[model samples]
Target chain A: MDTAILIDIVKSGLVLGALYALMATGLSLVWTTLGIFNFAHGAFIALGAYLAWQFSSADAWGLPMVPAILLSCAVMFAIGALLHFLLVKPFERRQDIVLISVITTLAGAVILENGLQLIWGARSKQIPPLAEGAVEFGALSLRNSELILMGLVLAILLCVGLFLRYSRPGRSMRAVAQNQDAAALLGLNVPLYFSMVFGIAALTAGLAGVFVGTIRFMSPSMGSEPLMKALIVVIFGGVARFSSPIYAALIIGQIEAFSVYFVGLYWAPAVLFFTMIVVLLIKPEGLFGKYQRTL
Target chain B: MSDLILDVRGLSGGYDTTQIFSDISLQIAEGESIGIFGPNGHGKTTFLKTLSGLIDPWSGDIFFCGQRMNREGERGSRKMRNFNYGAVTRRRIDPKAVARAGLIHVQQGNLLFPELTVDETLSIASTAARGRKGWTLAEVRELFPRLGERGSHKIRFLSGGERQMVSMAAGLMAAPKLLILDEPTLGLSPKVRQELCDAILSVRRLGLPVVLIDQDVAFLEQIIDTLYLFDHGRFSGRMGKEEMPDHQTLMDMLFGEAH
Candidate 1:
């Protein structure tokens, strides 16, 4: 590839990595803490994207993008809590909760897709970029939209990391993730924690949706791509460590970007999948996950 | 002096449809230590669980501090029933109610949070016991001096003995009037077991009533003032501290002549 093309690939990789990290961090948190691999996570992202698209237009509401993003996140949080209570909590004690969550989330994904089609119609929708400019540095040109997405992802990740590290409820969630029975004995309400954690996960997915929707077209099926990418990133990063998703996302993004330029568009996903399989076979615990007693 | 701390009359409960124990009645007074001795699969743990509100007895009444305990439908119930074969049934009694009633149950195995430092665990325990004037973290650290040194270490990094001490300290932080210990020394080394026994006796010295449940007669003999021998879901015999028999008989009762 030419130097300009290489620079473009590198920039694309960083942008993709940031969005992937944002999407997968919540999955990792839920997996490590609640032991539930929420397949509907992508659906939440799609919902956020569609909401933002609806709000971006200067209709009677005329809501700004930042406020629209926050509103979408808040709505997603409530939806997340509802999902936890209705779908997750009832099956909490089941030994097959992992499998059940997959099926449940798959059902949720289908429902969300169809529901979006019914309400918003099947046509693709777009949200205008938060800003209308591009930054050029040497051979590389970065869209304002990409920078805004990166900024939003970083800000959300920092807030979430701080919350999990410092807040009392956040500490309790960590404690439960490490040892649930102990958390309960300490009078930490396990169900409440589950709901709160799921809500946070949904919030992250929602913000990511807005970023992704602004950059690309929003549709019912938009969740599938990022959902797959997030799952791959989370598995590659190891579920136990908090920073695993970031590293995994970076690696995957760079490889995807490079493969797209060197090989073909269809070949990039194949390379990503091959990398995931190799990592799983070589180190089943993912790159950063620790082997510990799970709940 | 005649007040009853816990009273169970005709209490019966089991897993699924299979009844493990029935018509079991027991009572404990203030500041009295009772040791529960039973053979394997005799429902000793089940009984403790039923009392803690972790499980629902099939038929019985549980009264604590003169209040009838509705184990069937109460929120955050305390009945703790663990099953090896099937689903474990656990009902958490409201921590507030448990504190008000001065009851704390330290379950088997290492129940400490693996990610939390020993000090954080104790601090959380102290905070949970804020409604009640219970033991402080400093006093708990004093009780288990090893805990003092390992305050910053996570429970996962601690030795089995150290973990047990942390669990005990967390339980005692509630300063419960009635402390229930279910197999407190299951996986401990001999030295650690001895330390745990010493800790129990020391806690008893502070005039806190305790319910120590174990299959080992020798350990119970050291700290228990009274013994309730359980056999096949029934209380087979009751022995006072002075009336306890030799090791051979207790061993025979526990394992049934090894054949």
Candidate 2:
């Protein structure tokens, strides 16, 4: 393998990993807090991209990329709060909530996806890059947008880590994740925090969507692929620990990059599925988490 | 009575369709530390949960700090409705609001997050019920010296007594006006129980109200002056501090009766 080729693969893998990390963080947050999978997560990512595009597109609002991303996150947060109250909270205490929430979120996802199609149409769209041109590092030349993508994603993930560790509200959230009853009894507002968790998930998911639009392309149905990949990362990372899925995302990214290079892009999904099955068979608890039966 | 810190009337609450306690009533004056001793599975913990807003009452009123905290409208409506139906429509007490109003419930089994260290647990607890000036980290450190010594150790690594200490410390950090403790010394050895009882006495000295539920009558006798006997989901009656039973005598009465 050429050194330059290896660097390109590593660079691409890191970029892919950043995208997965952002998407998986949202998925993992929702799952850990709500104990229900948000099937609408993919739609959330796609919608975020679409929202950013609407803000930044020369054909639309034509805002700058930074402010557009910010607006996208804010809108995503509001939508998350609304969906949580309207769609998720109603079924929260149901004896079969785990099963029921999926349906509700799936309904939400279908609506959002189709709504995207109705609004944005079926054409593939890409957002304006965060940075134009390419950067050279020795023998390798990297797209400036990809480099920015990796940096921005890593920054967000780092911020999330710090927030959960040191911030009072974040610690309260961690407390809830550890024991809901305890958190509530301590006077932590469980429902409000649940809504906030959804909001955070939406913010992160929405940001990932914008990245996808910049790095790849966005269509109404584009969210499904990334959503599937994120779900795999969450399962591989497990819900017991907060940082587990992050490392899992990066590892999966490298595997994906290498596999796509060695094999073909079309066969990547098969290889990934095979890898997931093997990981599950060997360690049902996840790579960094204790065996926790969620749902 | 200075003020009724917690006043309960016609309190009927339980999990699901099963009524664990029915028409239970109790009162605690300001700065009053009370003990509840009951046989296992007789709704003692459920009563505390109901009071703390962890679970909603089927029919009851909880007046905390002269404010109605628990849902007065519940009044048997939840019981009358379909099973688990209240999950959706039962708009009962928001435990967070209850806690914020200065009533803190120290739950059973310690319930501390296994991943959080004693320091981290206290740090998070400081944010809870932030309306009141909580016990400073220094104050909590003074109250539970063991916590200070092992501040960095995760809860899972702590001893049973240490976990209980962290739970109590966490509750105290919330600056609780009324602290409701459910089995603080459930499975501790006599030495650890004595240590906890002494620490609880220190809390009592600070003029904080406490509601203790424990099988250890000896431990309760050491701290609480008035003891309530809860049996079959009702308060059998209140016992004067002097009238509280010894451990062996209460044990015989509660468990050895069948044998």
Candidate 3:
């Protein structure tokens, strides 16, 4: 393999890993707190991208690109909270909440997808890169958008990691995740934490959506691919810790890039899933996960 | 006499459709510690749980800091009540509100978040010390030097004794007017239990009211001024530390009720 091409592929893998990490972070969070998968996550991404495009485009809100994306993230947070209240919390105490919430969130996903289509039209849209052109590092030329995307993902993950590790509210969320009864005993509002987790999860997913729209093309169904990748990353990493899915996502991204390089694009996912199954068979908890009480 | 920090009467609670204990009443005055001794699967834990608002009482009242904590009302739909299901006007207890009101419970077995560091657990719990002068982090760290040494380690990775100490320290961080221990020393070795007993004695010295439940009457007698022999979901007998009956008498009390 050419050294330049190898470097490019490796860089692309890192970028893909960054994207997967962002998407999986939210999914991991919702799963940890609610013990339910947010099926609407993909739709949230699609809608988030569409929403940012609406705000940032010269035709609509005419806002700056960064502000537009941030606004879209805020809106998505509300949508996430609404979805939780309407679709998720209703079956919170049910014995089959894990099973039932899937149906509710799937229904919610359909609603969000159609709503995005109705509002934004079915046109494949894309967000312009944060900047035009690529930065040159010796022989390697990296696109400004991909580099920015990785930087932004890293920054967000760092902030969230710090928050969960240090901040009081973050600790409360962990408390709720680790032991709801214990959290309640400490006077931490469990329901409030639930809403907060849903909101923050959607916020991260929305940011990922914005980037996905920038990197690829946005359609109502654009989030499906990223959602699938995100799920694989989350489970392959571990469902509990915030850091596990991230490292797993990075490894999964490298696998995806290498597999796509070696095999055809059609066989990439098969290879990915096979790799995940192998990792799980061995570790069970996850690649980076410890056998601790799940969050 | 010290002011009554907790007053519970006619407290009956259990899981859905099954009553664990009924009309169990107790009072804890400020600076007083009470102990409950009973066999496994009895209502000792349940009683402590009901008082801390971890579980709702089937029918009872809980007064914390002289504030009416649990709202007594008919739960479920009126139709269910008509069918004699949950017909008793149960108490609606929010554990958060109860804990905030300073009724803290150091629950038995996996009480603290397994993934959180001891420092994080204590700091987060300290947030519950609302509207009162609670212990500072420095004070809590001083209270449990072991916790200070193991501040960075996750609760799951800690030894059983360390975990129990962290649990108690977290409870103290809640600035509890009254603390409830549901078998804090249940599974510890004698050395650990002795360490815990010393810690509990230190807490007692700190003048915090406590309600302790343990299988070890000797341990309970060491800390609690009043001992209640709980059996079959009720306080079968009550004795002061001074008048604690012999082992044969205590066994007769337990066996007398079991049969």
Candidate 4:
């Protein structure tokens, strides 16, 4: 266990944690507020990565790197809103809503995945890093992209945390999450908040997609890995508590990074799932979550 | 007609396919106070819910502030998750629409969002005030000084009585043209009930209409301009302020109808 190797592992863990936090926060929000997992979340990430590639490349928009990513995020937001209203809202009225949402959103994921393949081709696409140079401190080294990704994730989380705390709509969203009937009595538009939550969730997932695409190659199926990690983070973080997912994401990210470091890459999933089982057995609610209202 | 803030005609509503009450009707003139007293499971709360637009009448009409409050026709095919069978039919006005129209319902048992701070609960109503003449959060605090003291505390952390006070304060913050309370004293101690009765008395003095439901006739008698005996989902008797009968007589009319 060299000091430099440990620092390198910690650096990679933090970067992975930052990416997981972005995706998991969105997953946590949609689940807590809507009580439905946006299974299309993974598809949204793939869409975002492909969109970012198209926008940044020379043949397409040839846009600057930052604007390209931002544009991709905006598009994902629109897609999320559309998916919610068109595909999800109708089924929400049915009995067995959880089942319906699962079926429909999984179908939506298929459509989005194939849609990406049709548009962007099945080949993996790479996005250039927003910054090109790495910085070294003593024996520790960090890639410029990883540093930027971590910073951006922290900045987004901070803004979202503040928004949910101080802004009126943000407060109303919390009120709805806490109690929809009471919120309606106070004249809060529940459906409007639903759309906003979905939009923002998709936006964050898309941003994560773009950041990951910058670091690694993206394919139509790339979203599956991130989506799996995001779900684990959300469950580990607790569903309703906003801050839980961030911590959960970081822990899961570090575990995956270090497990890969110690064991082989193949053992990462087994180790990760096993750790989650242990955590769930002890705190079924979440590592950071409080006892939620049961019915 | 405009002076009648709430006018229900031949209203019948209940859990789907089972009518709780039928052919029921009532009216509240501007600034009027009405009390409904009945035993539990006798539809007192159901009637209040219907008036607040939380439930739809099986077959009836409701008019609030000269606007038809029961959304009877063309609700635009919005599927309702709350309704039985998750149907797309429209029977009740959207509760938000009803609240916007100034008929606010404070549901039973201080059902505030448990996680929100008292400040946030009141702020929801204040932000959605929509220019209806009602108390601002500052004014609500002035009305219920205890709320001012506990403004920063979460509703879940409050005492039962404090939660009730927060509920009432939140209702007032919405600036309702009319307020409906369902069993505000349901679980309170006698002392807390008295305090709540006093608060209701003061709230009535603020020149707003109120419709109160409680099982306690003595408490209802304290604040109501008129009292209605409710039993088995129907209003069996009505008494003006001067004509309020003794507790035994009122009890007879209520439970007497129960069996």
Taking all chains together, each candidate's TM-score versus the true structure is: 0.87, 0.94, 0.91, 0.94
- For model 4, how does the per-residue alpha-carbon lDDT over B1-259 read when each residue is reduced to its tens digit? 8888788898887865477987788888878899987777888778777777666667778898989877673223223435444334433567888888888899888557888888988887787776776687777777678888898998889988899888888888887888888888778888887788888888887677788887676777777888887778888888898999877877766557554
Q: Which candidate ranks first by lDDT, i.e. highest?
A: 2
Instruction: Summing lDDT over every window of 10 consecutive residues in candidate 4 chain A, give the lowest-scoring window.
Output: A286-295
- Of 1 and 3, the candidate ahead on lDDT is 3
lDDT of 4: 0.82
| Candidate 3 chain B: 10-residue stretch with minimal lDDT | B82-91
What does the TM-score come to for chain B in model 3? 0.89
**Separate DockQ for every predicted complex:** 0.28, 0.57, 0.49, 0.52
| Per-residue error (Å), model 2, residue A213 | 0.6
Error of 2 at B77 (Å): 6.3
DockQ value of candidate 1: 0.28
Report clashes for each candidate as comma-separated counts: 17, 0, 0, 1
For model 2, name the residue pairs that clash.
none
Each model's C-alpha lDDT?
Answer: 0.78, 0.84, 0.83, 0.82
| Candidate 1 CAPRI grade | acceptable
Off by over 4 Å in 4: A293-295, B73-91, B257-259
- TM-score-best of 3 and 4: 4
Better of 3 and 4 by DockQ: 4
lDDT of 4 by residue, A1-295 (tens): 7999898888888989999999998888888888888899998888888888899998778999878888888898898888888767766545588887998899999999998888888877788887888898989788787788888999999998888888888888888888887877877787788888888888998888888888889999889999999998887778656788898888998999899999989999899999888989999988887777311
- lDDT assessment of candidate 1: 0.78
lDDT of 1 at A148: 78
Candidate order (lDDT): 2, 3, 4, 1
Give chain B TM-scores in order.
0.85, 0.89, 0.89, 0.89
